[model samples]
Target: MSNLTSHEVIILGGGISGLSTAWFLRQKGISFKLFEKQSETGGVIASEYIEGSVMDFGPNSLRDRNGQIRKIAKDLGISDDLIGISEAFKTRYIVRDGKLQSLSPNISSLISTKVLSASGKIRLLKEPFIEAGSGEDESIGEFLERRIGKEAVDYLADPIFSGIYAGDIYRMSKKSVLPKLAEFEQDYGSVSWGAIRSKKEKREVKPMVLSFKKGIQQLTDAITEKISDHITYDEVLSLKKSDSGFEVATEEATYHSLNVISCIPAYNLGRILEGFEPELSAELMNIDYAPMLSVQLTFNKAEIDFITEGFGFLVPRKERIRLLGAIWKSSIFPELTNKDQHQFTLMIGGAHDRGILTEPKEQVEQEGIREFCRLMQFDARPSVIRSRLWKKAIPQFEVGYEQQKAKLDRFEGGNPGLYFGGNYQWGVSVPDCIQGAEGLAEELAAGL
Candidate 1:
């Protein structure tokens, strides 16, 4: 007889999505065992303190767009550690004409901004007057080009969304990547009008870009602290539909549960469920993940030549640059650095540059530094340089994602006690993961 454990629910994976789901499910009085492959939790939310510098090996900042993450942190009793971005350093920049240019949220800023030419700015201004596009599935690049112009798509849409998804704008679905703008065209017949009306209806909540004083791992560690006993450090080998609910086999033992919530990545989850739900498994495998290289570099404050105000800049693919963009980590949260130390987390490899991940680390780092310095026209080498490679970092929301999502929904509905929730279908952010957890928690609570 195999070593077997039983529970009311079985949660797979130990990333933020899984932990958050487990946290909420437990609140609803659910009995579940969360099986994580890694010995420690926090999955990609890795943070470290080394050589007098605190750094997040994965996501450095968390955007509390829906305020869910903030509340979750407070509930976890780590609210006091939340460090908000410095108000003075909130300005965003983009590369244009081989120089860093300020990028404000206001569309009106385009009038005086050098990021776009007169023709491009005029084209952007005429967005309100442009007729709504045909309600059809379209790529973000195609959608923006139709509404604004090709110039805006290349300069604005390409780099901005690239920074987020690290994906090809021409392949990313507008409905999936940015559903709100797509909805604006469908409902209000004008993107600008929909934005204005939505703002008027809902109170303006400035989304906070924050990180923990210790690092992003604080929230994950705190979650694990509360539910430590319930988590099992074992890889789920496979899951199958069973008479009672589902049979989950792990490296250590076979666990039986009345319900199952899968929070694993699509790529891995597909393999685990392949023997059970082949069709859904096939769909899950269809999703694409972007490779990323997280390169952290620092310099002494006096060596920096350029203005270090606001957020960092994103490099557009059109510029023939290998780097995606970078963020000023020290500027955002002063606690992460030594006194007067300038730190930046530069990004390389994405949908476009998958090959860079396979190259020699020294060569790639050297090239990245050279390009970055030339672009900024600054003359200082980083005193501290650290690099981490993520093979499949973020899932790409490509065209036809809705169908892929619908298939999963069908699987969940067809199998009463089985469910799927993660950053794959829904948006990929700390807040999005939390939001998915809240929804799944309610769903499991009501159903079970």
Candidate 2:
């Protein structure tokens, strides 16, 4: 604990947030060190090569918005390895009445799609006429229902959003979950009209969703390569305010830094900050996370009769299913699997059902398989590559997120040289973290 070294900045956690922050900081030639409580740099962003398949136990893909992913990939000289979704496989499916129904956000498709009833479709058309509510934070579920009708919310919005945040829309904040949509409502008085106007004005392009050749971890690994010397693969025990600056005690040694930035999970950072900032720590702890169980398996094409293009299908809660959704990982990038082998990543449990993690793996797996097989109407036991349960996997931007956001903003003002920014502070996606890291790095570099 006595071995002390001074540095300009110290980064906590080596996930995408920490690594990306370090990459930008290193580019600025800022002297900083990153500490990760793991043997490797990537935290939840882990890739496993087993049975001729690249199984991503964490986020499977990166929806690159703001060009951050490509820019970083170019800077790392790995832009050549980037891949995107095949045009043929861009369809999305949602389960309704225990049947998988394709969702096409078009007038003709909306009228024909069985996911929403005829009346629901009529209500959807009425969105332009519906008056916008008073400006106030509301749940995503409520927002969607008020705008597009409840039927669409149940079959379309619910599962799609749940797939993203692993959260219940009824509890999650609309402002935090869909800021652009919320803004459109406030400015145009109708989300549908606002979207049409934005499109007419060519406001912005939808985010390009892509991933590296290896997996999502490739991005983290690339950043780690550039900043390898600056990272410590040791556990961060505690963080305290010291006479000099911020004192960080890790399992290996104690270090001091003039500036400290947290790129760790909210709960982890909360525990570390308990030593010096008890009130902020309490507030940080209040931010909740969703637990998830991801099962990746390989099925021989001959053994499965049903197969389709596009991303995957999500199981709406109304369908009375324990399975959350399954992504057609092989469809996204066939290179990740062997010839004639299809890989599917099944997700189970979320904010709605944390019990899946504690339940028996065999029972849960069987039930999930039973439901999936019923949907596919196939009878075959596929080879299970890997099944990993991620506890507190994704942060929930639930109701009252503003309070937490406000406190975090004030905390930085009250505490000098102490900054907190990560997925918890901005977004949970890889691109979101990268985008946030870029802005935060520039801000920190200027301050330094």
Candidate 3:
């Protein structure tokens, strides 16, 4: 066996979380090494250029509500390359009665919008009267159904969260997944009232969905550039606690570190902790992941009859469509495609249709394309078709998530110099992952 290499801190998984954490540690002048199983970094963040169109295989864009994301971009020297979506893309669509319906962007339009029925809108008026309940965590569907109505849960919350997590809202925990909403309920006894009060308390900022000139991968690339030297391409086979700290064995060599931070998925981390922390491993192993597939297709502009407007439409389960949603990439970012072509990214196979992930890739693509054509009223064959399947995509914050969180807390407390930070810990968004990394880096730096 090769002699064990040593580092002050070791990061497992070279995804955005790992790369961003390494960048922050380097900024603090802390010593660390990042190990990735894959040959290249970025994990699922992949940008592909086909002919003249640029397609993002993973996340299309990020919501930068706070300036932290912009500061990171500036630090990476890629702020100049940051591109914000057009104001015209503010509108979002949802499938209703097998047709695309635009959601109102303003209060007046919301009252008049056909997305929800008159009875549903009237039910929303009684939201402030709904009594808040105190108890264990509830599913997002259950919470929304109680606060608003079943109509809202079916029409609004379902499609929106499906687009975000590709998860089943009925199984996802309300407090764990949507903490802000839960806080609103707890603070004011009504989500609607709390939202209004909170909005008045805070200054309004224009919402921006941002990406790089090339793609979201630019953010990962810039971070990797800063910390490339400290990265090792190897799969972590096992992790065991030692007297000094922890020893991590990878395919290439074993490494010793005073502190170990895991940026990998929950299931992968569970495998590494099997013998060392069986209880924690059991909890981690129970974390459910939803399978998702992103299908990118290009068509000649003249071949499509429907106008590609706003972002795109999300398919509510009521629509009984195999597709979860589709993002109009060319419309959102004009630079992503050639002037003569339009690009669309269709998402398929969430918790509702996980079996799609097991089917042949060709069948999945065909089904997605068929749904896309049916939804958009297009008949012309796509000029280009490509697909990427993530068997374990987004982690589900299912019922009893608080128990798992408690387990993580206990494990962290019991095992010193061990930390866990990833999309699974905080959130599934790009900004959320970056923020978690920043916080973890600060904690580790402070301890050092």
Candidate 4:
């Protein structure tokens, strides 16, 4: 058998995390090859252009203050193409009493919005007196209920969770998912005080929040152009110990590298490393993920109501709606839609709604359309249904997340050439993924 040559580093999985990792490695003048399972580089950042309108399958827009993502774009020479969400419509909404309601538009609005009950607002006043918990980890639901009362958790907080994680907040680990809140409790002894202190802390540094001028995929496309020939679309069939380093086998050939970064999701990691690292793989397999299906729809701009002029709205579980939320793509970024046609995107079925995604596609599509019409009060049905299903799209940071983190720590300590990073490893956000990539690159380079 002919021998394959080796590179200084090999990146597994072609998603943003892996691509970002390779992006930094390239800047460091290090030799590396990136392998993606699919032919494309962007994993969940897939965007579709229909009728001159932009539609997103995942991550419609990233926050503007994401310094790491923004810097990466600058390095890629696409910073000028980035755009911020319409400042006039940055506020989001939540569903309550089977109707779309505007959330607090301002600090003053918090006291006026009908989204929260009178008792709920009064209960929040007690936050300064509520004591913090002494524990390794706590669920997000528990934390909110203890601090602000169940109404805040159910209406204000839970709807936000529905949009972000699609996982129930009652089971999400506060320490893992929302570390800042956890830190707030630790330092100030009360969340209300923490918020007050946080304002002063934030004042010290100006935070920039925005998204790309084109779609987010533009950044990845630029990265791919830079490192075009170096990466391959070979799926890793198995991992094995080699004389010099490690070997990864694809269907057609085997590739060797001195160092490997496994950027694949936890579920995929479980499969590829099951034999090479059984115990570690088992622990990784236990990290439950949820499916996210997005339905992108296009409409006539004139048909939309004036109320639908914002980022969109999130539906809490109590609403009993199939969709988690809808993005007013046209309102937030009109470039995503044509001037004549209004563009909107909606998401449904997360870890909490596994049962929904498990059903047939036709059913999911119909359910999504029904929910969109009912919640957004669309004048007409969607002209097109570009439904995309992400099986095991994001990892759920359940209550026992620290134990899983501990297991990953031990696994990484033992495996020198292997590295893991993504939304699964860190908090689920564009900034977090970028931070995870940079951190992983430093770790792998140090080991080498």
- Who wins the lDDT comparison? 3
Task: Name the regions of candidate 2 deviating beyond 4 angstroms.
Answer: 1-7, 201-207
* Residue 144, model 1, lDDT: 90
The lDDT ranking, best first, is 3, 2, 1, 4
Highest-scoring model, TM-score: 3
Question: What tens digits encode model 3's per-residue C-alpha lDDT throughout 1-448?
Answer: 4333454789998998988889889888988888999999998899988979889999998898877778889998999999988664777888988888888568786687777899998887689999997845999999999998988778888999999989899999988987877888888999988888878766455557898888999889898888888888899988989876998988878788779999999999999989887878878988999999999999998877657668988988877888999999988998778889999999998889878767898998898899889888898999999899999989999988888888887888888889998988978988888889999999988887
Rank list by TM-score: 3, 1, 2, 4
Give the poorly placed runs of model 4, Cα more than 4 Å off.
1-7, 202-205, 446-448
What is the per-residue lDDT of model 2 for residues 47-129, given as tens digits with 9 covering 90 to 100?
A: 88887788898998887765767878999999998988665356778888888888665677777888888898899889988
lDDT for each candidate structure:
0.84, 0.85, 0.87, 0.79
Q: Over the stretch 1-448, how does candidate 4's per-residue lDDT look in tens digits?
A: 2144566687888888888888888887778888898988999888777878877788888864537667778888898888777764657788888887776457677887778899988997788888878856878999889989999888888888878888889899998887877888889888778777877754433456556666878877888899987788878887766876788887778888768888888888888888788887788888888888888888766666655456788888877777888888888887667778877788888877887556997798788888788777766866667888888787899998888888887776676676777778866776677778888777766755
Off by over 4 Å in 1: 1-7, 204-206
lDDT of 4: 0.79
Q: How big is the positional error of residue 388 in model 1, measured in Å on the Cα after superposition?
A: 0.8
Model 1: per-residue Cα lDDT over 1-448, one tens digit each: 2434455678888999999999998888887788899889987788877656777878888888767788888888899999888864557888887888887777566677788899998898788888988889989998999888999888988998888889999999988988999999889887888889888776356688888978999999999999999898989889998876789888877877778888999988999988997887787887999988888887887887756676788988988889898887776777788776777888889999988768987888888888888877778988888888888999999889888888888888888888887889557787788888889899878875
The C-alpha TM-scores of every prediction are 0.96, 0.96, 0.97, 0.94
Worst 10 residues of 4 by lDDT: 201-210
Q: List the residue pairs that clash in candidate 4.
A: 64-208, 64-209, 64-210, 65-208, 65-209, 82-213, 83-213
Colliding pairs, model 3: none
